[model samples]
Target: MSSSMSVNPLWLFKVFPFLRWWPMVNGTATRADLLAGLTGAIIVLPQGVAFATIAGLPPEYGLYTAMVPAIIAALFGSSWHLVSGPTTAISIVVFGALSPFAEPGSAHYITLALTLTLLTGLFQFTMGIARLGTVVNFISHTVVIGFTAGAAILIASSQIKNFFGLSLPRGATFAQTMWAFFQQFDHINLHVMSVGLVTLLTGILVKRYTPRIPYMIAAMLVGSIYALILNQSLGDAVTGIRLLGALPSHLPPLSLPELDPHALSQIAPSALAVAMLGLTEAVSIARAVAVRAEQRIDGNQEFVGQGLSNMVGSFFSAYASSGSFNRSGLNYEAGARTPLAAVFASLFLGIILLLVAPLAAYLPIASMAAILFLVAYGLIDFHHIFAIIKASKRETAVLLVTFFSTLLVELEFAIYLGVLLSLIFYLMRTSRPNVISVVPDPRASHRPLVHAPDLPYCPQVQMLRIDGSLFFGAVNHVEQRLLELEQEHPQQKIIIINGRSINFLDIAGGEALVQEAKRRRRQGGDLYLYGIKPAVMEILQRGGFLEEIGPDHVFETRDEVIRHVFSVLDRDICMGCQQRIFHECKALPSPGGKPS
Candidate 1:
């Protein structure tokens, strides 16, 4: 590492896109990339269709999203595991934002969707260029947990109509669904139910018995087979199960999004919200995999990659897209070598979809729903949820608040609430630093064990420990506590602070310490610091507080000052003290200038 730093090769951010990772490429990596890419292509098939429908777009759009955007994102993104495509979270968010603007499954709706996608991409690209990846840092872990749980609920709710073969209206809120379910109890579709049950069971069995085979595909196969058998037996017209129909075999059609000022204005805010959500999801997933892979994720580069991918995807008839957790997890499990895996997956998927798109027309909607239910179930992190609930009251509160708020409030706003709450709670906790007065363990027969700070102090010197960063947020609390210590005990004049735990000190904090030192000196007392760190001392020195605090009063060892300070103590108090805390004081003559 060099002491001086220079700007990285900025041109690499454009050309070849993979130039940043080209140095890591080798022979063993190629094999790993191939396996991961194959797994990703197989897995993305069902997910693409499911996500596109969720976004209120034609099924082809989802496949389109998985093609060009994925390859571009992989080559440009910082992480090897992050596979970009249409995801459940992004799909649901798009549906929520655009459904109110135009009727779903209409030309007007499609136009608005494309416009929104363009705007969202532009916003994300702008944020990336601005290097504002730190924006996600404000969203605490609790918020993420809570938001995911709520999203899980929404996912299950959205698929409930298909799961039970009912005719409840699409896009119903949780409360609305419950009410609608009760009202529509008589309109249950039995053919849809049979296919759904078979699909659900097949998924479960495949997972338990043949874990290597992707359960969603296995379930869809079983469901489709059952539909075919039923169609033949019932003469096709009697059954109610609807199929996806065939997809057009071609490149994602190039098209321009609506350029109207009113159209862009209408969806701009919602687009911004989608952009933030997409970036957060992508970065978070990348970071998680990076930790496990023993790799470092470049957040700024990730932003740029995601932005470019979405922008390119929008023109190719793809809707809003982001990092798919399922694809990324599968990639990691399959031993991905590099970002090339994502590029390959998209390429393979394009070829596979063309061959098998017609087979999807035989697959029932109920089967698709059953598959999505499994997807929804997998999104929830139950073990972590339980741990958070048990570990900390503040974290638990944040989780519950975020989880519930996500359902009732707007998606973007709920994240803000959780972040704000976490910050407020954090500040409240750090404001009060624990100041403890300690002594050497008297009960230890062999060596000195560091004792609790509440132990009685020496008659000659008061020893206290400051256990937190001294900053503006903590100034008043620390000052008040220190002043209270003096007021409570008038006899405790000489003060020694064990400054080992003071990790940081700011200007306001240094000034506060200086002021406190002057007040103590004026009252016929001196303040001393032990084990002063070079870093903390530098702050005091630079701020001119070291002169006021008196450099002579600082000590490296506990016994040095206490031995000399004992000579100046009152003899009556020294003789009366039963606690022989310090060996040095006990070894020396009594304070009255007489031998012990």
Candidate 2:
């Protein structure tokens, strides 16, 4: 018996896959993950506040997202390196969807946000239960690469108002935001710009020279010190710089979503949109990290985890949360070995909030914006972007389309557009399977078969290879090419199909094969298949295609098939053919019983 068949099933572990990593948790790994967690927690401090501000909620609501949702997502998700919490995209979406219905930062707005989160979670969880994990497969790698790059630009653009201390209109598009900035350039506050530049420079230096320390902490400290010195020298009234003010020092409090039918109906479309965006962001980030970590991610399990996180988070004051590229990348780069780092980061954040909530009053908004600029810059994977450009033209098209759509269109529509384009390109490639003509190379020791287009063969035989699935979509293509072969080259009636690459065969493909066999038999030859896959063979047998073509027409070995066909060829036709393509052609009996 094969070892694969002898292996016992780990059903319990599959249901709770985290058990595989739990046993490896020693003190060394714990300490490493804790350090990574500490770094991640520090970074999220400014991000949580920034994202909440984007969502038009009080900063504490963003902190609440980091607490419970981060913990729950880490524990239940399949990726060890994925960290889920408040994200800029989700926050922007929430604000856009709910701001018109209720005033920003109002009690009514918070209620609607929570209700939307609940509905989004319910939709995501239901999708996961239905085993719709393959949905993300349509979102190609190129699409993700392009989307993240576009999102990075959006992040930087969104912070331009704060970074330069411009009072632009809220919720402006990228173009409008830039136009507003240029129009208000003369009104830029020199003092606020100085603070932001100092923070940005400090972060760049630290990250370049001494990367062991968290750059955000160093940048914020330097910016805060500069603000204090400026305030002392020029007077607080003169500097005109604003602070983030103090944050709530307590943990997330229990809350409830408004369950009114009117409220649910109003937010239903937005909820569906948010659910898809959140799941896509989370799964895309997970797969990205998993690639770096050389780990496997179960997208379905991640969906269940994210769904449960948001559902539970709605009651804990979190608006909407998803996988954060900044935090997850930091977690992996900081030596985190498992999901415990995310859990620790959530817990450490709660404790850190108690001590540092007062210090937030001294942190300037310009400094926060500068740190976010750094985060946004980091998200654009330039290496992969360049590689994709140089690799395939189709992938490059997907990347460019996805990138532009993300910047120019609605966020949900951008995602859908990328996935739709990817599927269309994939179908276009698969619908026309590669049908190549091949010949045996007499000089080669291994891989003896080589493609030889326009090469001459035996007068009575034609050898070809099918290098894709034989499904309904591809049946017509294969049949049309085979029909052209018999119509154009009447002498080459015997067709041998090398089916080594055929992985799938449907009813339509089976019927096409039977039809081709019958046509060949009427021409004093027949269709033969070699190296057919078990699945295709089973389909042919079930459809009675094998009986019609005759079981003897199938060959297990290429050599046997070629030799058998050579011996049965008409001796009169063999005498005129000078090209002996197959070795068996040499052994054909001459008209007088001498070797041909």
User: What C-alpha RMSD separates each model from the true structure?
Assistant: 4.0, 4.2
lDDT of 2 by residue, 222-334 (tens): 99999989988998787778888889899999999999999999888888878877888899889998999999888888888888899999999998899998799999999
Candidate 2 stretches with Cα past 4 Å from truth are 1-11, 14-16, 26-28, 92-104, 232-238, 260-295, 332-338, 445-447, 454-456, 483-490, 518-525, 547-552, 589-594
Candidate 1 global lDDT = 0.82
Candidate 1 lDDT at 172 equals 66
Expressed as tens digits, the lDDT of each residue in 47-73 for candidate 1 is 898888777888888899999989888
Model 1 is weakest, by summed lDDT over 10 consecutive residues, at 446-455
* TM accuracy, model 2: 0.88
Report the C-alpha displacement of residue 397, candidate 2, in angstroms. 1.9
Q: How many pairs of residues collide in model 2?
A: 0
TM-score versus the correct structure, for each prediction: 0.87, 0.88
Among all windows of 10 consecutive residues in model 2, the one with the lowest summed lDDT is 7-16
lDDT of 2 at 473: 92
Q: Largest TM-score belongs to which candidate?
A: 2
